[model samples]
Target: MSTVIKIENLGKQYRLGQIGTGTVSHDLNRWWAKIRGKEDPFLKIGEANDRTTKGNSEYVWALKNIDFTVNQGDVLGIIGRNGAGKSTLLKILSRTTLPTIGSLKVKGRIASLLEVGTGFHPELSGRDNIFQNGALLGMTKKEITKKFDEIVDFSGVERYIDTPVKRYSSGMYVRLAFAVAAHLESEILIVDEVLAVGDAEFQKKCLGKMKDVSNKEGRTVLFVSHNMGAIKNLCTKGLLLENGETKIYGEIDDVINQYFKKSDAAEGYFTSAKLDKSEVVFIRSIRLSNQTGRATEIFNTGDDLIVDLELESDEDISKPNIAVGIKSKNGFITIGNTMLDGNQMPDLKKGLNKLSITFRSIPLLPQEYFLGIGMRSYDCKTFLMTTKEIGYFNISTRMVDLGITKPMAEEIAMDSVSPFIPYEWDFGNGNIQSFNILNNVIK
Candidate 1:
């Protein structure tokens, strides 16, 4: 396969402080120098950030000496934490942003959906905007007309296709924007975390369309998303970036492992909490344990989870209320039953207390998870304290199930009422017995 995208020692630098503050004079000087065939006026700069302090530096490199090649028909996944230069790379590929250093080469026309309203004309009607975006992507008016109805239907905005996009809901805007980008023809597709919006059905449809576009049409796609699930499903290869540098490139799993190694906290917790009212109240630590009753980073499908909340309150009130929450990696908070209510007989006094909350069955499928906890007064109306991202845990399980975690099962003794078996008995006497499989099986 030919190299569709080649990035050679690519580097992008951003000056510290507000942009445009001191840029007008520099811009004018550079423009005149370029017109007069002279070197850039402000090319000399000291080495980047002092690494001593975490404070912002006068200059920073968003990408540094990056080199990679994407082959034709390759669906490459770019994974990185926020500000890791993933978007910078995508923007360079799409020509939205120019690299400050090095060079990049592309072999095909690219359509980028880097942001929610990117390439959209808010003043124009949705229908007109479709043609505008298509034309910008090198599609002729006739080609857009040929695919107009399909785009409208796919976007589910046929009724409002003539309305100005400014009036459309965020969902509606995303739907139409994504529809145009995904459906219209292009040699290369560049998407960056735009699928994080829209409903589940729309996300699924977009994923399906992306798969079809690459597999059937053999288009080269460069995708950047924080959603590991989507990345795993849509991309055949993964590229991990950290602090504007490529940490791992090639296989998806290898990239993901390297990404975790870099991003995970030192304590292996999703979050750390330091109570503000330290004089009166404080929370030292918290964690979720797996079935083996050990502090583990991985879990199985049917493991019983124990959430341990270790607290050190200077002086616990007469009645203290507390609740623990488990948030999915996608930010869905799964609220579990709490013991802080007056209905529970337990009394939480002063000093350090080790509270263990247990759940027989965990509903969440195998994935990274986050934890949140809260404390309140017994009145159930007064808020005492709350902690977010208390910790992070990994529930590592195979692809056995999709949505729900549990599957019902039953066992029977050899002599117990004949094991239920659903069957139709044909008797010559003209009488027959018929029963449901579950009913008979449990008989």
Candidate 2:
């Protein structure tokens, strides 16, 4: 495959409090240094873009030393926490912003959807906006006309196509905007998190269109999103960014693993600060472990997973119900409540108390999952305290555990579900097969 986009040492720096270097003196100083073929004085004083901590420098590199390439027909996913410079990098690639340093090369015309209603004039009707966007992509009137009906149909806003976009809802705006960008004849497509503004069905449609453009039409795509499942599904490659710097770039799975590794929840432990005092019962800490009591976040299939929870209450209370839920990217896989099994929780004291919930012989397939805790009233009407995603755990299957040979395991198709169900195969000729039959393990 040929490289369609190449970037080397790309960076974008910004003043902390003001624009244009914050002062004319600083601007003149930068100009003088540049005129003398010297490095900008401000660049030397810039600091890493750590938003959580206060820094002494007046300039911060929103993106620093980014280097990567996108080949023809490759769909690259850019992922990071908020303020990680994912959007900045996309803007530079879209030519909406210039990098502070380094160079990039693009081999073909680029179409970008960076934000809701991006490149759309709110005063113009959606129909007019589509034609305007197509023209801006260098498509002639004839070309725009050829794809107009398809765009309108895909957007599903034909009734309002002639209505001014300023009157459209945010979702409608995104639907029309994305329809235009995706259907246009650009060799490269750049999309940021703007697709999130659309509904789930529209988002799915957009993903399909992006895949079709890259796989069927031989175009390149760059996508930025916080949705890991979507990223894993669509992108051929992944780029993980952190603190405005490249953390990992390679295979999508490896990059995603590296991203999860940075999360404190992945450590399988969490402790609440003393400063976070609650009027009612509150979680103090959470710890995950294997049946052996060794704290860990990684587990193999059929492992006994345990959760140790600590809670503190200001006053003694009766009927304090606690619930725990395990969730994957799609949705909740299982939920265990103290009331479910007719086992009432013990009365809470005025101090900290410890509790344990064990899930024996977990059959979840290989994937990342999160644990959430909720403290509710006895009737489950009021929530005293709730923390979603307190910790994360991973589950992988072993060939031996599955009672299958390595080759057979490799050949088996895995479904996208948690808590793999056990089953048996029987042939009328007196042959029967069963595997991993551990049942009723949640406790």
Candidate 3:
């Protein structure tokens, strides 16, 4: 396969609270350094793009020293948290924005859908915009006409094909814009997180179309999305970015695993120092552990999971309820509430309080899951403290350690969204059998 896109030492810098280097003097200095064949003087002062901390530098590198290559027909998934420079890299590749330093090489015409309504004229009707985008891609009028009907049909906005795109809903814009980018004759396609605006059915359709575009049509694709499942489904390669630098780049599954590891490591433990002091109740610390009471974020199937929380309340609360929820990538899988389970929490005092809950013989299939905790009134009317995702943990079955292929493990993970529960089978021939499949495998 031939290399279609090459990036070496790519970096983008921005001034704090300002645009275009923030002043004419800084711009002039940069130009002077460039003409003298010297590195941009500003590059030396920029800090890494870590949004969690306050930095002393006036400039930050949104993306720094990014290096990668894409071969013909390769689908690359860009994975990162928000503000991790995924969008910045895509903008530079799309030529919508220039990098602060380094080189980029592209071998063919590129089509990009970086955001909603990208490459579309707001005043012009969607019909005209399609022809206009095609013309911009160097397609002749005759060629645009050839693919027009297919694009309209795929977008499912045929009823409003002649409507001004400015009047279209965000979802409608995404549907039409994606249809154009995917159906056009460009050799390379770049899609950002904009697909999230569309409905689930459209998102599925778009993924199918992108898969066919690369696998069957021999075109390269660069995709950015927070949906790990979608990324795993459509991408052949993965790039993990953090603090504006490439953390990992290789096989999609390995990259995704590394991403999850980083997430679980960073969030598995928490302290009250990170919380807001204005809250009525303060959770000082939270931890996850195993049956033996050893702190850990990784667990095997059928392991007893433990949660420990230290909290303080400003005033005595009567009949308080505590809840813990487990969430997968898609959404919440199960919620354990003290009130619902008939285990009422004790009244919170004015000072420190510690709480713990044990979930026995967790039968979760191999996958990563997040934990959220909350405290509310007994009547479930007022919330004292609540956090959607405070920490994360990973569940691994014995098959993963026994050399099962990564894809096979992932397939197992996707097979069910709920934990495996104990069950018995009846043959109806005066025979009955009960088996703990997960426990047997793990034990």
Q: What is the TM-score of each candidate against the true structure?
A: 0.73, 0.76, 0.78
The local distance difference test score of model 1 is 0.69
Candidate 2 C-alpha lDDT tens digits along 136-165: 767788988999999999999999999999
Off by over 4 Å in 1: 20-53, 114-118, 122-125, 159-172, 257-273, 287-289, 292-296, 306-310, 315-322, 329-361, 366-368, 376-384, 396-443
* lDDT, candidate 1, 1-443, per-residue tens: 89988989998877777887768887898899999999765554423333334654467777887999998889999998777888888878888789988899888788886367767889999999999887877789999999999999999999999999989888888888888888768889988778778886787778888888889999988888876666766788999887788888898866765665524454333333454743344566665566677765555556666666666666656656665666664454454433422233144557776665654456445456667777766666666565455666654443434343221111001001212112232222344333233453554
Output the TM-score of candidate 1. Answer: 0.73
Backbone clashes for every candidate come to 6, 0, 0
- RMSD to the true structure for each prediction, in A, is 12.0, 8.4, 7.8
Alpha-carbon lDDT, every model: 0.69, 0.78, 0.79
| Candidate order, TM-score descending | 3, 2, 1
Better candidate number, 1 or 2, judged by lDDT: 2
Model 2 lDDT-worst window of ten: 406-415
When 1 and 3 are scored with TM-score, the better candidate is 3
Tens digits of per-residue lDDT for model 3 on 75-193?
A: 99999989999989988998989998999999999988636766789999999988887777667899889999998999899999889989999898888878878888889999887
Weakest lDDT window of 10 consecutive positions for candidate 1: 407-416
How far is 126's C-alpha from truth in model 3 (Å)? 3.1
